[model samples]
Structures are given as C-alpha cells and as structure tokens.
Target chain A: MNEYKRISPSKRFLINIVLVIIFIVVGTLLTGGDSLSRASRALILQIGIYVILAVSLNIATGYLGQLPLGHAGFMAVGAYSAALFWKATLNMPTPVSIVLGLIIAGLIAAVFGIIIGIPALRLKGDYLAIITLGFGEIIRIAIINLSGITGGTPGLLNVPKYSSFLVVFLCVAATIAAIHFIMHSRHGRAILSIRENEIAADSCGVNLTYYKVLAFAMSAFFAGIAGALYAGFQGSLFPKSFDFMASINILVMVVLGGMGSMLGSVIAATVLTALPLVLQALAAYRMVIYSILLIIVMIFKPSGLLGRYDFSLPGLIEKWMNRKNKPGKEVANE
Target chain B: MVFLQQLINGLQLGSIYALIALGYSMVYGIILLLNFAHGDIIMVGGYIVLLIIAAGISPAVAIAACIIGCIVLACVIEKVAYTPLRSAPRISLLITAIGVSFFLENVAQLLWGADPRVFPATRIIPATSYQIGRLTISLTTIVTLVVAIAAMVVLMLLVQKSKMGKAMRAVSEDMGAAQLMGINLNRIITFTFAVGACLAAIGAILYCCKYPQVKPTTGYILGIKAFVAAVLGGIGSIPGAVLGGIAIGLAEVAVNALGYSTWTDAVVFVILIIVLLVKPTGFMGASMNEKV
Candidate 1:
C-alpha cells in the first residue's frame, strides 16, 4: 500500500526551521545589499505586511465563515494605536519600543475587535457585514474627529521607521505560526465546524459566541501587528489609508488566495502587491484588470485558487519517497 | 425659521437617499446578494449625464441617456458577472459584486480622471427659489422631492399591483418553487435590476443637482449610506427603505445643525450600529427563520 504518510513532528519542525532560515537569508540579502532598488525592497516588505493581513482575515472569512468587511477598521485601530505608542516612546531603545508598540497595537486592536465582535456577531451574513462596515466607518470618523491626537486629516507624520526587513520577517513568521497552530488545534476545528454549519456546530455543543468572538479577536490581533508594521514602514499614518477601499483590497487578496489556506494567502499577497508595481506603465489599468480578474475568478472558481489546499514540503518529500518505494500501489490521501 | 429651512433641506436630502435606497432594497430583496456595485452604477449614471451634457446634447436627452445608461449597465453586470454565480456561495457573489464595484470605479477614474466635475444645475433644473411662509426652498429641492416621491410611488405601485411584480415576489420567496411554477427566473432578475437601476439614475441626477458635483468615488460613500438605509428599513421591505433613508438624512442634518458638521458621517454610522444592535431585522423587516 503506497499511501502518503504524514511527516513526523520533529521532521516538520526541522523543515519549518530550514524554510525560516532561507526566508531570513533572502530578506537580509534584499535589505542589506543594494542589488535591488529601494523601491523593490519596499515592495517586498509591503507584500509581507499584506500576507499578515490576508492570513489574519482568512481566520474570519475562511475559518470562521463570516465576512467582516471592516478588516481595515481593525488594522486602523492597530496602526493608530501603535503609531501613537511609538511616537510617545521614541526615547526608548528602538527594538524595545517597536516590540512594545506591536504588542500594544495588537492588544488594543483585540479590545476593539471584542467590542465590535460582541455586538456585531449577534447577526449573521450580510447584516454582520453591514454592521462591521458601519463600525469601520465610525472608527475612521473618530480618528478624523479626534484630530488632536490622530492628527486629523493631515495625518500622523514622522513616525520612527522600525519596520526593517528583519522585523517584518519575524512578525510574518510569528503570525503564520500562531495561526497555523491555532487552526490545527481543537479550537480551529470548532471554528471550521462553525463555518461548515453553525447550527450543526451549536448542536455539537460548541460555544458559538465564545469561538466566534475568539476567531474575530485573533484575526484582529494579527491585523493589528500588520498595521503596526505598516505604520513603521510608512513612518506615518492616515485615517484615509484605512478606509473601506483598503479593507476591500485586503479582502480581495484573501478571497483570491484560497480561503483557509495560509500558503494561498502568502502567494496571493505577494503577487497582488507586486503586480501594480511591476506594471507601473499600466498603472491606470491595474485596478481595472484586477477587478475583472476577481470577477472572473469568482465566476469560474468560487473556491479560489487553492481551495483550502496548503503546501507542505515535508508532505511532498514523503509522497515522493512513497512513490519510489511502491510503483503500482499509489493512493491519493487528499 | 432656521428649523423650518433645515427641515426642508432634510426632506430634500432624505428623498434623494430614499430614492437611492429603493434601488438597493429592490435589488437585494429579489437576490440575497448585496450588489455592492449598485452605487457604482449610480456613479456611471452621473458620468453619462456629464458626458452627454458635455457633448452639447439637450438636458432632457442627457437625462434620458443617463437613465438608460444606468439600466443597461446594471442589466449587463447581472448577466456577465453574476448570472453564472447564482448558485455559488453568498460570499463569492458578494466578492464578485465588490469586484464589479472596483471595476466601475476604476474605469470611471481612468476615463474621467479623479477630479470632481461640476454638474451644471442651471442647465437642467432651473435655479429658482420659492419663498413659502418663512421657509425659502430652492427649485432644485422641490424638483428633487417631487421627482423622488413620484418615482417611489410608481415603484410601489408596480411592485404591489403588477403581474411582473408578483413574479418577482414569488421568485424572492422561493427561487426553486418559482422556477417550478414556470417563472422565467433570469427575466425577472434582470427586470428587477433594470427597475432598480432606473431609480438609481433618477436619484443620481437629483443628487448631482443638489450637490452640484460628480466624481468617481462619490458613489462609494453614497452607496454605503443607502445600503445602511436599506438595512435600517428592513432590507427586503420597500417602505422600510424610505423610512430608514429619511431617518438617516434627518439625523445627518440634525448633527450638522448642532454645529458638529464634521461628525455627520460618524453620527449616521452610530445610528446604524445602534439600529443593527437593537433590531437586527431592522424597523420594517420580517424576521427570516433559518431552516435546518
């Protein structure tokens, strides 16, 4: 029997460590060496931020099976909170301030997420979407109106640039790992069960409110970290940057990437973030083309590019070894 | 006198919102989809009016072209983008609608640039005012209210008293049953979109006359607000849309009058959150029980 065997935990850990090392090496090469243009490096960093955003959103839209249109709202909360923190603690060591800023950003965004999620998740489907959207708008308006602190329409300027390639790499890795572990645990299965059938899940004795809010808060938490990275990257923050369109852009990435697939989110985020930059000559047509593509993708493949399939190097290696050992007894596991 | 003037202003604005919200309500009632592109269709109508007027066409012809343009666009979007995904997950359809929305907004931006165009009010509606008692109402506001009310009344009559409307109701009630009953699902859906688009075009024209500007991104916020109205009114209910619209418009005006003009948008959203939290089904919406 040539069935694909699961990789051992220790081997999987080794594979992950190797992959992370490779990522760090590449990141260092891009940031340290002047081989690529500054713009290209910045683009890569932006892709990393979007990867965090997309994967975090997947927790809600994919695993939880609820569409919250105001992801950027949470991102905005994280960004503004982190920016304010960094701005205030500029006198501290850069690394210390940056770490604290990210934590504060994540925690504050999680708080807002709980606050929004509790009331918002009481409804389902489109009603939930509209409510979250309203909350998003409210947050943005609050930021604008509280200009004394948020800098109003002029935006918060001159933030410390602490989002180097290393920082972003570490954050992206942590986010993916955290999400991967949570999604693999019993809690993840419960979240998935809700997505599949909320009523069935509730009948199975899953605490619907607790898990829904939990997934939402976790999603908001990572989005907050990404926002903190973004604030540090841009060295400024604006309420307008976290508007509805920005949320939609991130959603598009998650949707295009197969929902519930971290690998898909990473790849889609990378490609989409770089596409506009690469096609600078067709900049005017970029969004139009992107939208058309989105429509086409939805129409043809509603499950998205990956359809919940995740990539695993160890799994691939195991399958290859199995194929070599048994030529005629091949069996598909998935 | 100030309160009276503000009331008139609120009514005018609310009527425009009600008109737009009707389009949202009608389309959403028939299809469980949000049609996020609905607002962009109104933006397209605004561009059509601007272009036709710029081409030196008569104002009446320009307005006609605008309405037709919007109807055609909405119908085409339904056919091209949404028809195939009728059986897909609701989220997919919603995302596709967002795609269409971005597509329209980007196309408008590409064709017309990102700058706002000054809609010539005098060229269409006469720039006259009526001094009634202590309230001075502009002719534009009167025309907007009259046209909005007239369109809404006709829409209500059509939906309530017509055979096609019955077909639409049947389809919305149960698509599979409606098909079994020999209703042409595609035709009814397309017709609903057309009717909704026509109203949106009318609302767009009135909105332009009232605001005196048109831009690509204008529809995004306007659409969200109208969607809020639709939600606040009971999404599938027609009269609920109007009541929700008027409530939002009045609340906005009241905030502005309270010298918190900058917080108008915030106030509108606050009302929406409160309404949704307190009444998820909205004011006039019938609660839909989920079947296992």
Candidate 2:
C-alpha cells in the first residue's frame, strides 16, 4: 500500500543513522557556532538530562507498574556522589574524572535503589508511593546533615561544568538506547507481565521480587546518571533541587509521556523542559499552569498522550516488510 | 520540669495533629483515596479565619464561618475534581488530588501574596498562663487539648450512635453493597468530606493559635506529617489516627528537646518507614487481601 511501507529493514536502519547524523550536525552547528544563546544551550542541556530521568522513570513506573515517588532521591544520591567523586579526583584529567564520576554516581544510586526497592517493593500500590516519598525526604535530610560530604544546605559549589551540549546529548542517546534494549529483552517482558497482573505473573513463574527490584535498580541507575549530568552542567549541587517537587516534576514527565513509552518520555521531557523557558513572560503563572495542565491531562487522558503505543524503528520496519510481502492481500482489500 | 512542659506542649500539638489526622484517615477510609487537597482546605480555613478576624468579627463567629467555608469547599472539590474520576484508576485519583492541592496552593499564593501573615490577635482566648511550680501552661494549649479530646469523643459517639454515621461506615465497608442496600452514596461521600473539613477547620484554628502565623505553604508540610500519622495509626482506624498523631507529636517534641530540631522532619519520615516495614497495615489497620 503506502510507498513508505515497502522499505527494507536494512534501508530503514540506514535512514535512521542518517537522520541521527543530521541531528547531531544541526545541534553542533547551533551550540558551537554561537548562533544559539548561552541560555538556550543551557536549556537544551537541561532537556537532555530531563529526557534521561523521564525515560528511567518510565521503566519503573510504566514498564514495572510501580510508582516510586522518590526518584529525585535517587538522583540526589547520584548527583552528590558524582560531584563528591569529581571533587576527590581533582588530580585526574577532567574527561577521565567526569566519566568515572558518572559511573560511581550510577553505582551508588543503584545501591540506594536496591536498599529502598527491597523494602518498598514489598508494598502494594499507594503504600509504596508514600514509603518512597518518605525515603526521598530521608535522603534529602541526610544530605543536609552530612555537611562534611554534601556541604549541607548551603550546597556544594565549584563543580566543574563538564556537561557540554555534546556530552549531554550523547548521554541522553546512550541512556535511551540502553533502556530500549532492556525493555526489548525477555526480562522486560517479565517486568511488563508483572505490571499487567502481579499474581498472574508470579503464578506463571515470573520472579516478582527479582524483576521488581531489578527494574527499580535500573530506574535509579539512570536517574543517577541524569543527576550527575545535571551537577556537571550546573557546576553546583543543591539538596533543594532533588526534593519532592523535583520528583513530582519528573513523575509528571513520565505520566504525560505515556508510562511505558520511551519516545513519549523523550518528547514530553523536551516539551516540558523547554515550556518554562518559552513562557518566561508568564513566569509567575508557570507553576500554576503546570499544575493545571497536570490536572487537565489526568482528567482528559489518564493513559497519557501515547497510551501504550510506542515508536519502534525495528517494529515499523517489520511491519513495512510484512506489507511488502503481502501486496496482493492489500490489493484485494482495496 | 522542662520535660513535663514539653510533654504538655507535645500534647497540645498532638491534639491538633490528631484532628488533622482524623480528617485524613476518615476520607481515606471511606473513598480509598488519599485526599491530598484536605491539607490545602486547612490553609483555606486559616485564611478565612484571618479575613473574618480582620473584619472585627467575634472569634466564635469567625470559627463557625471557617468551618462552613471548609465544608463547602471540600464538598465542591469532591463534586468537581473527584466525582468525575470515581471509576478511573486509583493512581489517577491520587494524581488529581495532588493537582487540586497544587492548584489551591498556587491560588492562595496569588490571592494572598506568598508572605507569611500574622493571624489577627484574638482576645476571645486570653493570652494568660497559669504557673505551677516550674511549669507554665498556656490557656491556648489547654483549650486546644480540651477541644481536641471533646471533638474526638463527639465524633466517636456520632459514628457509634448516629444513622448518618452508620451510612458512612457502611459505605466505607463496601460501596457496592451500600448502594445495593439503597444508601445514598453521593450524600454519604459529601457528608464524609464535610465532617473531615470541619475537623480540619478546628485544627487550623488551633495551629494558627500556637504558631500565630499563616502562609500559603503552611498546610503542605502539616498535611503530609498528619498523613504519616494516619498511616502510622492504621489508615482507616479512628483511634489509631489519634494515637499515631500523639506518638508523632511526642517524638517530634522529644527530638526538638534533644536539640535536633533540624531533624524533626526526617525523624517523622523515619518513623513512617519503620512503621511501614514492621507493620505494613499499621497499628490498628486490618489486613486486606488485594482483590485483583
């Protein structure tokens, strides 16, 4: 039928590669060539970090069907740890130290994730959300009290601004790809099954505890990565940034994007991140608008804009190939 | 002597917390929805009380108006934001509650600028203190303690004795069955919201009396902590909510006395975590098998 539906998988992959190359080229031109304002570049970087957080949250909330309200807590753990690592590794080269900082941040966040996930995942539904919220507050308070390490409420300053547009863009791409890979795997199906029916999944021999904890840990890992990126980009770390409202903002993204959809997360994250900047003229009404939008969206489309729909390049290609393989059947229907 | 004083203060604060926690527990029990907007209703009541007092009304009249305003506001919120989503996913309802909370907070900020306002000084309750040896008990604290206990007793009696309360209990036990038994589900739900808001109004006045200031964001923290109290006491249990509130109040006062005032919020959360871990159903909550 459609001309576009006749494309082969290999050709579709080539087209995607070309499109990505074009996107990178355009980004480089905008950020590096001084055509874009510094504020706009910063906004783009922030969007990149938000995309990572939203996608990670989607994994836990969308795929795993557990609403962990303490995502910001994980991000805080990652950010502070990464910044602390960078501070400690001052003697190392900047790039090497930054890379190491991200890894350590992610690992630390994962550890916290596991710690919280074990106790938290044992809970069902709303109880889990509240407990995670408590855990988030606990993390934030702990950060404030550990003044020696996190620099207390005054915040840790002088973090190197290592998160350039390119770095952030690359990180966002990698995070999305990694998450996509995970969700496309057999384990992902197990996680999704748990979301559909926990009892049914368990009866079918799906390891509920193992999968739930693993999904949570994975969500925390990427959240930490996003936090590390944010710390580097901002060159400052504040306990206030990773508070409950921060978690809510990230949750809003995941919910707005359609829980289990990666592309939806990216689009929602980008739009929401950029919306405030674009609406700077209405600065005071920003949060009012955000809250109102959240309410309206929940009322109008509880399943979100994308619902369970996802944009998969491979799936599209497969459909295209199948269509090509059945030309006569389509003709008969026409 | 100081320990005794702190204990008294804790009781006063705990009484207010218990009132708020009861509101939370009641709504949660009936609807199976955590009414996040319930706290914002207290903020609204405080503002209303402040406005009425600024107009030179009697304190009693101001409190009555505040209670009526809260009751109407809670009923309107349920009818508008919550009613449409009655059959939707529970998470959506929770999100809507959060939305309503945010909307009310922002509206408050817009209406009364975000600055903290001094609650108008009321001469209805004299600012006198009774000194006994090394302890001084303030009039407001005593009033709060008395009002809180009396209110709880009245509420218990109402639930245990009244037809309306019977309807509420039946609805909470099973909405489908209650409807089948010809109960007016909407009226019961609305009545529950009104009663919860009335208690919250009382809590708001007591809170303002002790703190003497009100801000748009004031209710957010108090609401969450009271929610912690509700969960601690066993969410659906009335006595449990009060017990949890007192325990939380005492714990906070003890931490404050220990000079770790900064860790007060963290301590509450820690208690919540411990409770959730040790007793998922809370102190008085019955085990409910989640029906798929």
Candidate 3:
C-alpha cells in the first residue's frame, strides 16, 4: 500500500488516462464492427447507461450516505427534457443537437434536484426516503398530465436514436471521471465527513446544506445524462418507464455493488443489467432472483459484495511487484 | 345528496386507510423502523382469503384464516429477516424491509401468477343497498365502516388497558430501560408485529370487498398511501393516524370528484410534501431529539 502511494500524481494521471483510452478503444472495436449481433450491441450500450446511473446514484447514496428513493424521478425529468430538445432541433446537425440535448437534460434535472433537495434533505433517514419517493411520483405524474409536451401515458415517440457505442462509452467514462474527481476534492471530503457525522462536520465548519444539495444535484445531473442516453437508445419516452420500481432497480445496483465503491457500482451495474438478458429463459423468476439476492445479501453481507473496496491498476501492479520481492510472503488483499 | 354519498364513500375508504395506518404507526412507534412489508402482509392475507374461499370454506373461517396467516407471516419475517439486523444501521434495516417486501411480492407472483384474482366479496359480505331520502348506502360500505371502527375500538381498549399494552408502550418509549425493568423485548416486538399484521389483515379484507380484486402488487400503492397517512397524522400517534387516513381518503375522493381522477396519486404526494415542509414532525408527530 505504501509502495502504491509512492507513485506521484502525474504518473497516476497518466495511468488513468491510458486506462480510459484503452477502455474506449476496446469498446469501440468490439461494438463498432458488424461481427457482433444487434442484441449484444444493445446490451453493451445498456450496460454503459446503467453504469452511469449506478455511479451517479452512488454520489448521494454511497458517498453522502443519504438514501434518496427518487433517482428515477431525476432520470425521468432528464429523459423527457432531452427527448423534447432533440425533437425540436431536428434540423440541426445530429451531433450538436445530441450534445445540447444532453446538457439541457442534465441542467434541468439539476435544477429540479436543487428544488427538491432544499426541502427533502432537511429530514433524515426514512423521512427523506419517503419524501424523495413522493417527489419522484409527482414528477412522473406531472409528465403524464402535461400531455401537450410529454405525450402522456402512451409515450412521446420519434426520439432520435443517438446512443451509439461511442457516445455511451464517452458518457460513461466522463461520469466516472467527474465523480472520481469530485469525490477526491475538498468538497468531496466535506461530503464524506458529513456522511460520517453531520453534527461533527458542521462543527468543523463544513456547510451541511450546501454540500448535501451539491452532492444531490451532481447525482441528479449524471442521472439526467444517463436518462438522455436511455431516451436516445429507446427512441421513445414513457412515464411508466421511470416509476418507483425503476428507482428501486437502480438502487439495487448501488447496494449490490458495495456502497461508496465506484468499481463495485460499475461491476454490479454490468452484471445486473445483463442478468435478466442472460436468464431470458427464466424471465418469470428473474425479479424473484433479484429480490432473493437483495434479501440474502443484506442479511449475510450488509456492506455489499465489495464493501468499499475499489479497483486500481497501479495498486494491483504494486502488489504484484511486492509479491515478487518477498517470494513466500503473501500480499494481503482488500 | 351527491355530497352525502361522497362523504359516505370517503368514510368507508378512510376507515380502511385508518386500519392500515394504525399498523404502520404501531410498528414505527415500537422500533422506529418503517415496516415496508406491512402492506405486502395485507397482500398475503388477500391470497389466503382467496385460497380458503376457493377451498369451500365458510366466509367466517376464511376471514379468520386470512388474519392468522398474516399474523404468522409478519412474525416469520420479523424473526427471519429483521431480527438479525436489530443491531444494524437504520438504513440497513430499511433496505432489508424493502427486500422482504419485494420478496413477498415476487414470490407471490411466482406462486399465484401476476394476474389479479377476483375476490368473492358478495359471498363474504352480502351485496345489498339501502336508500333514504335520495341517499343510497351499500351494505358493504356500512359493514366495512362498522367492522373497521369496531376493530379500532378494540385495539384502543387493548392498548390502553392491558398489561401487554403497558409493556409495549414502555418498550417503545425506551427499549433498554424497559428491558432493564424486566420487559421481554423480543416478546413485545413480536407481539407488536402480530398486532400490526392483524390490523393489516382486516384492512385487506375490507379493501378486497370494496375493490373486488386481489393482485400481488395491490399492496404496494396501498402501503405507500397508508405510510403517507401515518406520516401525515404524525407517526407514533394513533389518533394522528386516524386523522391522517381520513384526510387522505377525503382528499383522494375530492380529487376524483373534481374530474381529475388520474391526478389523485399525485395529489396525495403533494399533500405529503406540503405537510413535510410545513411541519417536518407531521401534524401529530412529537419532535424527536437527536442523541449525541
């Protein structure tokens, strides 16, 4: 671990950049070709979207240590906003429209995050959960009732399918990087401190409300981006798609991935997103499996699968080098 | 006359909500944990009623079986899922409760299929109506109101006058202190869950008679709404639950009457948000002090 820390900041940055580039290149090569089936491509894209969703939720639930049950509400807001923006800018260049739509989606969701967070965050624990849930349901209801723009329950159609592999890959990488940077910064530490003990954090001069709202809005922002990607992938929007169950599904990913571990979130999201598809033969038992897994995991391993353990290439290499040096000594695993 | 009829309708619905809300209130009072599976317990009770009725059992026996089944399921869930997590963080307990709820719903779907079964309400509660001065009241409505009220009254007496009730109140007030005073914490907790389950089962029967259908997911919305009612009425307060339930029932009816039936769900949440904002403790909730 000491040897792992000896790697300077510049070297760490270089390593991260290389890893991301390798990931992007490999993803593009795998999905860019016509060799893979359409279903597989779609599945890969979906994994990317869910990865973003889980990580974004981790910002508030994992890092901030607050449970907001209305993540799907923010996603719904983003999905509809991006869908509307893209629908209106049909004549613009596709790339420009998609980029603008994503921004608008995220910003709109962030604005809502601020609006809801101010009141909702004042309460703690289960009250916060229920209040967020109420807000989420309200957002869906609003979308349904405002049929002139939202297209009501039947759904808004003709959304441009822009969530190709490259786009989704970049978005996923960007979300992870942004969250990673934010969590390492002073503000991120403040958020973590608050999660550990709110009163102590407050006494230490950390602004509780500001940081809480900030983490919440940032989480909402990324959730919005993921929602936009989802809208483009599906080419339609329905209020039903972003209901309480949808929120729970995203939450299940965050929980199943150890809370506060980005790598865990990514892996859990990937596995969960694919689990249903892989178990298509037992579709009826899929949710049953998920619920059972949730219960058993909570009971047996409440900290989750990884339990705050994150993966780092440099750390792995450091361990490998140490093992080589000590021959018989086993390097401890986290 | 229309207003009077709607008032009666509101009362019937409100009584059902009140019963469910009572369950939520009592459990929350005892453990400070929201039993998310409380509603699903009602769903299980609905299934039990359906099964028993199908087996050529008398309505009385079927109802008894449903109540007993709910009580047993609630106790089993407490022992299996929640007991181990007694020392875990509140969030973990909440998550486990959600897990238990989802498990119940999905398992029910796996066992009974997702399709809703028609509840034989007429066989259970006689289908009849009475009219007086242009006002009509269904026999089901009157029976639901009377039975719900009777149950509440019985529950009130039990809690206020019984030795077990005193122990329950003491435990809820301070668990460690009550245990030191020789109260059996485990027994009281299980007994609280059983009581809540009993109320939920009665609510389920009343709900099926009114709606005439039973589905796995039926409890989800009802549970949430009842939870909202519990919160609105000030959690841990019995009268508050009753008041909150009635208010919600009336608000829902009023929204539907205004010809915006689709918005009724949204309106209930709106009320919750507004109540939470204006009075975070709720209309009846005592302000809780955070311990260092």
Candidate 4:
C-alpha cells in the first residue's frame, strides 16, 4: 500500500502513455503497410471513418443518454461543405485545402448541431428520436431540391482523394483521444449524471441545456470530420447514402458494441465494417443479419456487450498492484 | 374547378393516411410502442394480393388472405420480438422495433426484388371517373373515401361499446390495476395489435389501388407519415388520428399544388416539429401528468 501511493498520478499517466505508444506501434507493424491489398487498405480506411462515427455517436447516445436519429444529417452537412470547399479551392495546395475543408466541415456541422439540438433535445426520449429523424429527411430533401448547390440527385463529383491511410489513422486517433479526454473530464461526469437521472441531475444544478447541446455539438463535430474524410475518400457525394438507413446502421454499431463503452464502439464498428466486405457474396443478406443481431442483442443483453464497463489499462494495473499489496482492501471496496 | 379537384385529391390521400394513422394510434394507445412494423404490414398485405392475383386467385379471396396475413404477422412480431423486452429500457424496445422494421424491409427485398412491382390495377379496381358539376373524380377515390369513413365508424363503435375495447382502455390506463381487475393484459395487447394490423391491411389495399406500384420499401415512407399523423391527432385518440391524417394529406396536396412536390416530406416534418414543440401531447392526447 505504501509503495502503491509512492508511484504518484503523473507517473502512472506517463506509464499509460508509453503503453499506448507501444500498442500503436505494434498495431501498425501487424497491419503490414504496402503488403496489404488495395481492398484491405480501403477496408482499413473505412474502418477508421466508421470508428470516428461510432465513437462520436457513443458520446450522444451512450454518455448523454439521448437518442438522436439524425446523425447522418450532420454528416451530410459536413460532407457537402467539405466537398464544396475542395471544389472551390482547387488552386490551393492539396494539403492546405484538405485541412481547411475538414475544419470548415466540422465547424459548419457544429453550428447545425447547436441549432437542431437546442429545440430537439428539449423533448424527451422518443420525441427527440422522431424529430431528429425528421430533420435528417428534411436535410436529404433539401439537398435534392437545392440541385444547383448540392448537384441534385446525380450527386456532387470530382471531390479530391485526400483521405489516405495515414490521414485517416491520424484522424481516428485524434477522435479517440479527444472523446476520451472529454468523457473522463468533469463535464463528462455531469453529462453522465444526466443520463443516470435527469431530475436528480437537474436538482444538483447541472445545466441541462448547455451540457446536452455541448455533447451534441461535439458529437456532430467529429461526425462532420468523418464525413469530410468520406467525401475526400469517395471523391463524390450522394444524398441517398446518408439517409435514415445510414443512421440506423451507425446506431447498430453503438448498440451492438455496447452503449457507454468507447472500446465497444470501436470494436463493433471495425467488425461490422469488415463483415460486409468479407461476406460480399451474401451482400443482400447483410442487412437481414444485422437486424437479427440487433434484436438478439437487445433481447439478451440490452446493456450491450460491455454494458457500462469501460476498459482502463491503468485502472487494471492499479487494481492488480493493490491486490498484490492488500487484497482485502480491494475486495472490501468491491 | 382545379381547386375542387385538388380538394378531392387531398381527401383521397388524407383518408388513406387516416386509415393507416388509426392503426398507429390504436397500437400506441394500448402498448405505448410506435409499432414501426405496422407500416411494413401494409407492404406484406400488398405483396400477398400481388402474388395471389398473379397466381389466378380471385381478387376477393386475395383481399381476405391479405387481411388475415397482416394480423398473423403483427401477432407473431409482438409475441416473438416485443414480449420479452417489455421490462427493458424504452430505448432498447425502440431499437428492437427498428430492428424488426429493417428485418421486414430486407426480407421483402430478398423475397421480391428491390424493384417496384407493377401492381396489376385494372383487374383490381375499376379506373372509371365520375363527373360532378364541373369537376371530375375517379371511382377509386370515391370508393376509398367511403370505405375509409365506414371503417372509421366501425372502429369507433368497436372501441367505445365493446368489452375488448374497455379492456384495452383499462390496460392502457393502468396495466397493473387492469390485471388486478381480471383483465388479461396479454390478450388485450394482442387484440390491439390485431385491430391495428387489420386497419393497416385495409389502408394498404387502398393505397396500392391508388398508387398501383409496390416496392420493398413502399411502407417505409408511408409508415413514417402515418406515425406523424398519429402524433398530430393525439396518439391515443382514435378520432384525432383521422383529423391529423386529413390535415397532413391536405398539406401534402397543397405543397404539390404550389409546385414544390419535392418539399412535401420536409414540410410534413417541419409541421411535426412545430406541433410537437407547441403541444407535445398532440391535439387530442391526454396531458403528460395523467399517467401517474
């Protein structure tokens, strides 16, 4: 016990940082850079984008405990903004324009997130779901009707392909880090308190509106960045791709992996993104399978695979050390 | 004359919406589930009619089978998918409902290709038009309006005067109390799903008759709009669903008349949002505080 206390908080954080770096290096080495087939590379890149989407959605649906069914709308907004920015700034250096597009996409989507979140989040659970769903449909319809700007149903073309594996990897890492930081912070605790009990959270002086909107905006921001990456990767944009089905697909990832668990989102997103590609012959049956999985998961484990459990290497290490030193104390706490 | 024609058109569409909305309202009132699968039951009904007609069965027989098929499907869904999740979190139930909805849509797609099937209409419903003063309305529209109104009356009577209806009301009011009072909660819930499914089948037939094309996803959009109508009219109130349906139908027609057909869906959602914001309980729905 005495030695465990002597280790210090900063020392533990450094050890965690070192462990993370080692894991990343090992992961990169195992992935095999250029030896990976083109299809595999594409899949990896797609997984990164989906990781960002699933994690960001977890922030809203899992942590905040509010279901917003229109996540695709924000993504659509981000994609169009980024694609249009690239199109307009063709004269600029590719790297400079790409970064600018991402920032612009995220900021624009954040603005929309705040605008929609304010009124929509005021309503309770299912109402928020439908209203957000309505907003998603409206966004798609607007994209179709405003043909001149959105290029109509034919879809916008000639978006630059700046979404390389390195860029996507970096973005995914940044997204995970940012979300992890926010979720572990005091603000995250406040948001989580709201999820556990809104009335109690309110009585305790948590600013419901402010935190709700903030979480929503942050989720939208990352989704927007993911959308921008998608636009750059696909080199085109279609409103049809970002409909209600797409939203449900992301929701499935969050639910299947385990709500309120970031690692669960990452694992689910990666597995689901790869599942379709692996079973290309049975592509038609993919959605049916997804639906079945969703129902089964809900029926059997509604809390999800991870439930409320979050993986923490440091926490695990600390517990192990405590057990070695004084097992009775840890047992008593449990 | 054009205005009168649009009115007839709006009424035709509204009545169909009302028929579907009634199903939504009934189920929601009793079980508090949005019944996302309710709309897909309409799709199943259409496919049954399509297949039966293609196989040389009489239209009347096919219609009967369609109604029965919908009821069976709704019952099966409730028993298999929803029963176990009754005590789960509301969000979980909603997600499961969505899963059921997607499952139905995909199953339809796999069974009958994603392409819209050209519903053989001439043999199903007569295509004749009737002249009224300076305006002309099709026979199908008149038939649809009459059938919808008749069904509404029958349903209203059934709910107000019947024993099963009273049981439903009691269960909805207080499930525990109703059970203690000897009402079979499961049976009442099943009965509600059946009634809702039956109404959806009728609406499906009417909708197929008017639109004449059936796709795997045909029910998806209509289902959403009907749900909106149910909410608009007061989800648990029978008459309110009809009112909301007609209002939405007219609004859709008006938007089309104003030469912005593409905006109809968006406009409907905007209206839904506005209504929800102003009166979250909907037009005829009881106040939120009454549940306690």
What share of the reference contacts survives in each candidate?
A: 0.80, 0.49, 0.69, 0.83
**Candidate 1 lDDT tens digits, B113-134:** 9999988768899999988897
Q: What is the TM-score of chain A alone in each candidate?
A: 0.95, 0.92, 0.94, 0.91
Candidate that would win on lDDT: 3
Off by over 4 Å in 2: A1-18, A314-334, B121-124, B287-292
Candidate number of the best DockQ: 4
The true-versus-predicted C-alpha distance at residue A62 of model 2, in Å, is 1.3
Mark the regions of model 1 whose C-alpha exceeds 4 Å error after superposition: A1-6, A330-334, B287-292
| DockQ values per model | 0.76, 0.66, 0.74, 0.84
Worst 10 residues of 2 chain B by lDDT: B283-292
* Cα lDDT tens digits for candidate 2, A209-257: 9999999999999999999999998889989998888998998888888
TM-score of chain A of 3: 0.94
What CAPRI-style quality would you assign to candidate 2?
medium
Cα-based lDDT for every prediction: 0.89, 0.88, 0.90, 0.89
List the candidate 3 regions with Cα displacement exceeding 4 Å: A1-5, A321-334, B287-292
**Model 3 chain A: which ten-residue window has the lowest total lDDT?**
A325-334
lDDT of 1: 0.89
Q: Give the CA lDDT, 0 to 100, for residue A144 in model 3.
A: 93
